[model samples]
Target: MSPVVLFDAALALGVLGCAALALTLRDRTGTVAAFMLTGLLVALSWLRLGAPDVALAEAAIGAGLTGALFLRGARRLGPLRARPPAPAQAAAAALGAAVLSAALLWAFATAPAESLYPPRVAAALEDSGVSNPVTAVLLNFRAWDTLLEIAVLVVALLLVMTLSPPRVIPDKLGALVQPFARIVVPVAVLVAGHLLWQGAEAPGGAFQAGAVLAGAGLALVLGGVRVDRRVLRRALTALALAGLAVFTLAALASQAVTGALLGYPDGQAKAWIIAIEGALTLSIAATLCLLFTGYGRRSAR
Candidate 1:
């Protein structure tokens, strides 16, 4: 086999192995670790498929943030004493998986050889006002979809707040942690800004940039950097809601200006997209951080 094929085979095997390991591991932490590994491998798969944006998202949010959340939950759960599922349940699951796989394969085999959307997108790209096709698609061609996604995040944040999950405070890691945070957090911020700025022309965008910022926030939280709770709460709330609010307002404004929802005026699409993306970056970052931290630390009664 060619080197590329060989590498792909290895990656595919690694993904499957890690996924199986995660499912079967008795230890919660080990299972979470394995799952995270699987996510990273999946991110690599996305890269192999020529989707760097998806890969970045998979690595940052799927693997990094999700793994941290799982780790925190695992620590709280303490011990694992649950019995395994019955044999019948396992058989049913296996049968379901087999059926789904067969159906997907069939669909793929029967599908049209060429997609119609690519040409449509390419034709409309000049008017979309962004050099990056991905950005144009996301922020212009299908902005309604993006709007709904932001709304979903807002709903999730509301749900999290309603449930009021307990906080897991990080233990101090010593003097080294402060120095580490000082260096890493600033760098993460810069990286996030770069990603946001380049997203209109490259693989980086609001989601990826926001996730990076959230990662930095997580580092600070984990590093035991102290902040005033009331102030932090207000700031996070504002930042978390800002993106959706701005997006909504923009949509309305666009409607008023162009007579179509989310439609930008001629020669102004890029400006609208950039403004919306800027707000989204901060909002997504704050929302993710708040979600992971369970809306910040609270005093234990």
Candidate 2:
């Protein structure tokens, strides 16, 4: 156990080191690479602390989605790298960082281990229709919060759609990348399904599953695969809106039966939650892919 503790402590230090390198690195691309590494290390720390769900989220979103976003947007990134500040400015920055870190530590020390929210979630766990407390809380106890979160995604997609034009990824991604993508894309799809299915009982969930699918979609894009514009629009819209539409419909249906929004019928909550998660997985993938690469503008093969 002490050895395990030492390993965890070492991992935490590694995470901090990677984060520092990410922030301080002069090379823009290297900085982004370091950021991705930091995210992976943070995910490992989350696993060490016994939070697989958070670990998965950090890996998928913080490392994967965010890194892809940075690379994708790199086309617009200016060639100018940030210059080092004056010594006085650097000292001010260091002081600000220390203050923030101290404040965070203080807050963590003062905060209770278990709050009222957890007890409520625990009390309702059996009736929440999911064995996993995190899933139950997100989908049952705080379904409205989840709905709002989905809405935020939709708004982001809409904003991106307005700003970005249809994308046509270059077809000449070296021979090695293309061949590797062919194998990876299918496996990622399969893994996404597994994560979605396992979320009901474990750390896997719609967000993680959707992120995996988005990663596959990104690979496909980079491999010169493009769907027709009309086809792409129809499919992406349907897939991206699936979650919001399904959840809203479910809420209305629940209101009719239980006199409350998103209220699942007795003994049928699991099915409802699962269905909602499935649609969300699709929606999230579509939305993310769109944000990364924009709409396809060529003929489908």
Task: Give the top-scoring candidate (TM-score).
Answer: 1
Model 2 over residues 125-149: C-alpha lDDT tens digits? 9998888887887888889999999
- Expressed as tens digits, the lDDT of each residue in 1-301 for candidate 1 is 8999999999999999999999899989899999999999999999999999889999999999999988887887777888888999989999999999999999999998987898999999999988889889999999999999999999999998887777657875888988999999999999999999999888999999999999999899888767986688679989999999999999999999999999999999999999999999999999999998885345221
The models' CA-based lDDT, in order, is 0.92, 0.84
Instruction: Please count the clashing residue pairs in each candidate, in the order shown.
Output: 0, 0
Q: Which stretches of candidate 1 lie over 4 Å from their true place?
A: 296-301
How do the predictions measure up, each by TM-score?
0.95, 0.91
Give the candidate number with the greatest lDDT: 1
lDDT of prediction 1: 0.92
Error of 1 at 42 (Å): 0.8
